[model samples]
Target: MRAMYTCSSLYMCGTRDSIRVAMSKLCTFLRHFGVVACIIQFCILLPFLCRTLPFSTYYGVTSGRINFQQRAKMLNEDRVKHANLYFKNMMASESYRHYHSIGNGTHMYLAVAVVTVRRSGVKRVNESMGYVLQTAAGIDSFARSRNFINRTFVFICNVDSQPHKHEEARFLEPYLPFTKRYGSSSFSVKDIQLPHSDLTYDEKMHKNTREKETFDYSYCLKVAESFHPEYVLMVEDDAVPHTDLSSVLEYSLDNHLVDKSKGTPVKKKFAFLKLYYPEKWQGFAFELPRVLELISIGCVGGGVSLLFGLMVRSSKTKLTHWTMCQYFVIGVIIFMLTAELVCRQNILELRRLSKYLYQFRQAPGCCTPAMLYPRAIVEPLTTYLTSLPSPQHTDLAIYDFVIQTQTPAYQLEPNLFHHIGMHSSLGTGDKDAEHFVSTFKIK
Candidate 1:
């Protein structure tokens, strides 16, 4: 019986020793063979970790709720501060002291026409400061900084038929060229006289306002044509220009829009070059070319990582079959591809830092805060816009024209201006402003 008990103890000890030895070998093998897999895993998981981690807890918060509210509050404060500053500047005579006027028969390289209407009934103090003032200040400041005041023409095209209703444009009249509708007639607000009693006054006004917007846009274009500018830039009164606005416009015109193959220059084959688009839509669009690009990047990264792993492993081991290594490589590729798709927004954020690194892609259908039309197309565009039978949003109308004509149109990435207006002059509040502070890429 004693010998049997001693044998049982020996067998248990041997089993424990065998398990420890096996675990040690497994650890050593993983340390060498699994290095690439570990790295791939880390790379794929990094974005998720950064997003999900409770880093805000270190700032005395359990979650990000307070942080988000604080950020929004700060942004509102900054916007109000800037708006007040711009309003003061617009009122000051010194701000436009050096500005050059677009006199009659003047030929300009670029003519900027800002379309504006009065915005009333806004509850916020910043909204009362007026978006037109801020936009004018931004453009005037940028033009003066770049010495573009001489070659460029900037003016306000006030669409408000009643001159008394739009005091902001009146304030700007002394500093900038101000255009208004010819007649003294105002849009009637009384809907009782209409045959359709079901439509509310607001609804009736909205329909009229839409048509007026289209007419106003056409009028501005015609006014722009009078200056004989080589390029016409149509800007919304609320769209604030970037600090590098002149530089980007110059670069875009010289590099992409103009054809200088012949001795005389000509416009490039494009309907219009859009300078701004909604930022929310500028994410990882599931397009064929973009998908192909991601796939190519994944393939190259996997191949490089695999080659590196094999080179290191070959130096240590003389294994003939690399079936496990090949499987690891496949997993790495899959992980990398998933990471590329998941973290695409981070990639775009990184690219936005470099102002010059912008791509021109086929224009997407959306708001048109800023657009550049070649001198040659201005008249034809004006004609087309005027001929439209029904009232349509200017953006949708232009998009329809582009589709019907099948003309090439392009939009710049990392938009050159910020859509800062919280209350739109078209009687609609910017609903998205609650979610996003500004659409400017750099900001």
Candidate 2:
């Protein structure tokens, strides 16, 4: 019996040892399979990781052995912080008030962004600057009235002459009031120097004019973006707003005064607030009222006009596209010249052609009805302030006090609506000009 019991115990011990060995082999195989499964999973995820993640992030992750998902979270957090900081800082800028005033107000805003250019002759550059200053002063005085209380004004002066830059600054400083001064008073005189390159001789003579126009247009666009005002008053350095400028603009803006009464639309091409002519000219001599309804203002010297969608800006690049650029103007001219070509041969619509014709018709002397009469008379008054001998000086002051109003509902005429600018003739020794200038001088 003792021998049998001992045999059973040894048999049970052997069975236990066999079971332990089997379990150990199974565990080793499972461990190897688990590693293989992990490798397969990583391989499956590799292409997805490459496709979903940016190359820079991917490189930083694998090469640096950084956790990819963790890094992505950190990056997102950093961007949020930057955006918040930018918003906070922007809220504290002068642009903020300028923007809000434009957005929340009912009145119009006029921004005369000026860039002084060197002329070809000894013509006083300061004369144009003086005109602009007086115009600004006039506008400021008008704003003090109830009619223009909601209006805002600005003049972005870009000095074209590099060496004489200080002179330009001095010319402008006296006109602007201390309270309404441009830029930070804390900035030193040295900081006032424009950080731009000098213009070449050819550029100064020709391209500089276009640049001035474009720069002004661009500045208007930028200021418009911040304010989204009801109207924009684009003026030139030589323009002086008439004393009744605010009243004129108000009349134009008030639809009841201008358009509402003429439900069928006023039979005029270009709209005008006031067109001043030299007072010396006999009204009947020019076959026009001393100042005919500025109905035929030409888009010259970039003044006395208000147009919308005529100017635009790109937020992405902060770059601007001006309608007055050579390329753009050339394209517009071509479109006008070839409207009949496409009208007959191409699949273009008549409406498109009509729009172009409308703009052209509005321009002075472009598409006028054939007549034996002289359309405009040259006015010469100033023998003027120039080295040039004699009364060779001419002052073509078209549409002064012209205010172009733009609202979404406003519609333009087609055939004779193309000329959307101020046009007035300037001549040396014209008695009419002399009287006009003398009568219009501010006391």
Candidate 3:
């Protein structure tokens, strides 16, 4: 009996040991399985995360600052700390940072994003910048009448990153209003420079200017998203906004004045509000006003035909009305050529009524000389702009994104802004772009 009891106790101990071993094996397998799954996920998703991520958490981004050596010589670790804190407080900067509010609830409503570079023999930027400020003041005045308050801030994006260029452009400091004032100021600067060993936009450059411009423009656009303005006024340095800018924007945005009354398909289509064009002007000149030119052509042409008909009796049949009309047209063409020259009066452009009155569903966005975009689209626009593969020029890239998103865009008639520079910044006097020819050049 004693031997049997001892055998049973040993058997129970062996069973208990076997159960413990099985449980431990199961725990080990789960641990290893979880680790392997996590590793796979990390490998699969890292590339995508590198491409797109919400980076607004960092408030004070001084990444693209030029004159890095100067920054190091004149600055200390405090600037680094500012950048660190910017990232530290990134997620909360949903809307405004320091520029939005001043005191007593005063706020800024408009932001003009201008991308500029150095241009030799260029005075158009000066006039253009002045007009932009005047437009800001105009907005202020209009807002005051309605008992609403607002401010318009300008963001000048300089694409040159070389320290020497900074020295050359030092004279531009007054109009830019930065480099001293920090801590949530209305203005800021960035250098979208590339590592071009010694390639200027002039010589057979190492890098593609089109690619560089797109990136630089993209960088400025991303910067604008951080400001959180009500509407983004995208303008080029060498361009001017119209005098009635405030009235036009106010009328367009508040009332949907473009296609609101037309009851057309454009009312439901995506759109852009363009403010500048070369042939477009303010006041009476809105319509190309070629009425006198057309009349002169016809009369001069008709008289010449009649004199020739009297001199040489070539046709025996009586003249029909159609024959006389053809003769009149021929005379008109002759008069047009002899009168001035085919410089500004493009027959095709003359026919479009858009030259006379504000048009809805603006022409395809070819240039960003002077345009407006709502703040709501900035975030998505940034994402879309950055995500494109091997984009073309910045203007077309942005327009494509706008179209893809189905947004309404409008263009001012008689062009609220005018091209102000004749020379290009990509290279001295380069005319690779058609718009760059007489002042619409973008750096």
Candidate 4:
């Protein structure tokens, strides 16, 4: 009886110890789970806390607000980073050869150019010859004077898919050397196929124009992707250049004179530069400035403009190049026509407020001169006139004076971005061509 009672008591003691151990473990697990729950809740509330509460409200966290002046400094840093990233990617891809000027702090690289030839025959042949000679001369001058080192110009011939025409062959003969030297051998002269549309005549015309613009935009994007340029300047075959191409670019980039008295940092869209033509081309559409402001937002102009370039680069969805280009353009137009209208009047109001607002002097906007005007508009009034029916041909001499006088005059206006227009050229041969080649020299 005594032995049995001792064994039972020992067994009871062991069972109590086991229960204690299990209960202790359960408490430890609950504590761990509570910690995890708290962490999850904190993470969920993080965004709200950071945004609504001032940095001073946070006990342990660092302050978020830097001074207003420091904002510009931060932006400049960001821009430098953006430019560097673009340049490195271009180099790593071997998309284009770098021909940069250390002195000017501008990198100019040329990719193997591929031009599309539309026609065939003797006229086509002569055009090709002129194009090749002009292109070679321009590039050579760029290399010699502008510090261009590595540049290749490619020509893509879009010939008819039919049997080789003698005229086409002759046209391509002069450019053959260029083809062998600086260009890619991707030669196929095919018809530019149009997408099918069932619409009325006006609708068809509008649609066709849009489609063609989209195609050209796509082609430019393709070239950019294939070449991987830090920044690619697209020039038509007919575009020519004048003397000192690099100087023009330097001049363009050097325009940093901003009107501190006008426009707040948030309101300004146009960068400070001298416009070659100040006259209202359409004789002052009250909405001209507003329209321009909207256009500056980019993707709205059927996607061939500077904004289109930005959209393709910024897409988050691992979009294919072709699809991205197409969708981006569409999005721009759709968004502009719809949502942009809501804020149009407000932009104008902000412009008026800039003149009186003292705080605006320190707060600068998000555009550089290059970002404002990708291409120069030399004579808006004259272009407008010529665009009319049966305009008389005038001497090219008058153009220089008009451009120079008008550009500086516009600089004096409240329209701060006026100066960002065309910088008048000294002399003119083929102004468009000259603007294309000379306006964007590396140095």
TM-score top scorer: 1
Q: Which of the predicted structures, 1 or 2, would earn the higher lDDT when compared with the native?
A: 1
lDDT of each: 0.65, 0.31, 0.47, 0.32
Q: State in Å the error of residue 229, model 1.
A: 0.7
lDDT of 1 by residue, 9-113 (tens): 999999988877875675466455545555655554554444432221122222345445445446645665675575564544543443344443356777788
lDDT of 3 by residue, 1-443 (tens): 99999999999999878866765675464335434433543344432432221121111132233343333323223322333343344332322333234222344566666665555434333321232232222322333333233365554555554423433223333333222111122344343222332422222222476766665565565565455666677666556444445555666665553355655523233335676644522212224344554565558767886555444433433555765665555555555443323222233233234333444444556777776776676666655655565757778887787777777566655566545444455545433232322222110
RMSD of each: 9.9, 32.2, 35.7, 25.5
lDDT of 4 by residue, 1-443 (tens): 89999999999999988877875675465435434433543444443443322211231143334342344334323433443343333332232222222212333343323232323343223332233223333433443454344442333322222213324323433333212111233332222222342431112222232233323322332333233333233333322233333444333233333334655422223212321222222122347564665666544544542244344332332435664455456545644543232233223323334333211121112211211122222223223322323322222222333444443311211222111111111112111211111112111
Estimate candidate 4's alpha-carbon lDDT, on a 0 to 1 scale.
0.32
Q: Residue-pair clashes per candidate, as listed?
A: 0, 20, 14, 23
Off by over 4 Å in 3: 1-106, 120-149, 167-169, 172-207, 257-271, 278-357, 428-443
TM-score of each: 0.71, 0.33, 0.46, 0.27
Please state the error at residue 88 of candidate 4 in Å.
Answer: 35
Candidates in descending TM-score order: 1, 3, 2, 4
Candidate closer to the true structure by lDDT (higher is better), 1 or 4: 1
Q: What's the true lDDT of residue 346 in model 3? A: 33
Candidate 3, after superposition: displacement of residue 322 in Å? Answer: 14
What stretches of model 4 exceed 4 Å from their correct place? Answer: 1-114, 120-129, 151-217, 254-443
Superior candidate under lDDT, 3 versus 4: 3
